[model samples]
Target: HKGQELVMADIPGLIAGAAEGVGIGDRFLGHIERCRVLLHLVDASLPGPVEQWRVVREELAAYGGGLENKPEILALSKVDLVTPQALAAKKRALEKASGQHIYTVSAATKQGVEPVLDKLMEIAGRAQAMKVESDKSWSPI
Candidate 1:
């Protein structure tokens, strides 16, 4: 590596019915539970974006560890594969469907990647600050 201070782990994606002992369920998803941030990358060109997102959520919730509340950055990956108009429409539908911050990016081309990374950094920084504040509040004065 580049002498990076932080470690990045790449875990296998949790599939449908993962919580019920489906394919590679227990083997990979437990790692996700320990993560502080979840970068959810959904393929937006799919026929039903909302339903797909919900199914993923359900799988995570069933797996437990309060992942449902963890801060998530939704990115409709593979935008380069779709037309701009189509992407925009899907993004809107996904936003209305998830009620969360959404970003569109094509990982292959590096389009729209910086903004998402910046936002994620900002979110992580805030969470760290809040944790410090919470810990301080609990200390005996």
Candidate 2:
């Protein structure tokens, strides 16, 4: 077994019409509401990173029910396939696209994992800090 005590499921990739019971959409999206954060792993080498990003964004937004509000860290996976210069460029593009710090990682090579993990931990810390800062309802956004 993996060392982690908790399990996270990778649901079927959300498709168009998922919210309307098209192709296991409801069942797949049901779990997203419970998550505190979402690591949006996108393939950076795709033809149009921004366009692909919007497709996913549109799918989630159309899903409705506040799912769109979930805090997310945008990440581009499979960096090892590209040259270093290309990787940096892709990272910049994704960061600009998502309006968040973008991480380029290759899970296979273990490159860039630590920084990505650090960002996730940093976000968690900020969430805790927010709780301690004010009892009144204040959104992180």
Candidate 3:
């Protein structure tokens, strides 16, 4: 475990019309506005994992508020529930669609979680460094 501290919040699910007050609605979407990076956890055991990833992305983009532009990490969760072959296939598909690496993980079995956390820490550290540098550049007028 790294010494860096990271704060994370689990927002409600985003549906097709989340931006239009559908499902849990996008009221909480703004909570992520200040987040430097977003971790999108998609269920690998679900049918059409890629489609599910796209739906969430569309919701974020539609909601605007800079959420769409923030860096994102795609995590394929529930990997234990699916076969290795299936997991590999879905991970590849998601990576291709997202143009980023997909971290396969199983929360129940604690499988493949460390890599995801490690990556998150790395990204968060960089973001924090940038924020510090930006703050140092400001001065009272």
Candidate 4:
């Protein structure tokens, strides 16, 4: 990865039923309205991780404001706590569920994190370049 920097805002409250203002998740979601991309950090060790992913997807879809349409990076965190077989299983499940590349990372062991950062940098950089081009194309005349 290049030495590029990206700002990531962790919307710490997103959970099931957030769109209905069921919890503080709704409040924090507004903060991400301007973000170019979303990083969904799902816990890999959770039971039925796919179900959990679906619940968040439902909330985003319900929340509206084009959140559902944004490009997303899906990651399964805390892989160090799970066995290799379990990690592979969870990864496969998430990839099938999201139809996107799934990344596994563990902070404690520093495993598979660099790829995540590199992906983020590439995507966010592309998004920023597009935004700049879009701004230049605006013509009120």
Best by lDDT: 3
lDDT of 3 by residue, 12-114 (tens): 6688989777876588887888788899999888999989989989999999897888888889999999998988899888888889888989899999889
- TM-score for candidate 1: 0.83
TM-scores, each model vs. reference: 0.83, 0.75, 0.94, 0.93
All-Cα superposition RMSD per candidate: 3.3, 5.4, 1.1, 1.4
| Total backbone collisions for each predicted model | 0, 0, 0, 0
Which stretches in model 2 have alpha-carbon errors above 4 Å? 1-7, 125-141
- By lDDT: ranked, best first: 3, 4, 1, 2
* Whole-model lDDT, model 2: 0.72
User: What ranking of all candidate models by TM-score puts the best one first?
Assistant: 3, 4, 1, 2
Give the worst 10-residue stretch by lDDT in candidate 2: 1-10
Tell me which residue pairs clash in candidate 4: none
Candidate 1 ranges beyond 4 A from true positions: 1-7, 133-141
Query: What range of 10 consecutive residues in model 4 has the weakest lDDT sum?
Result: 1-10
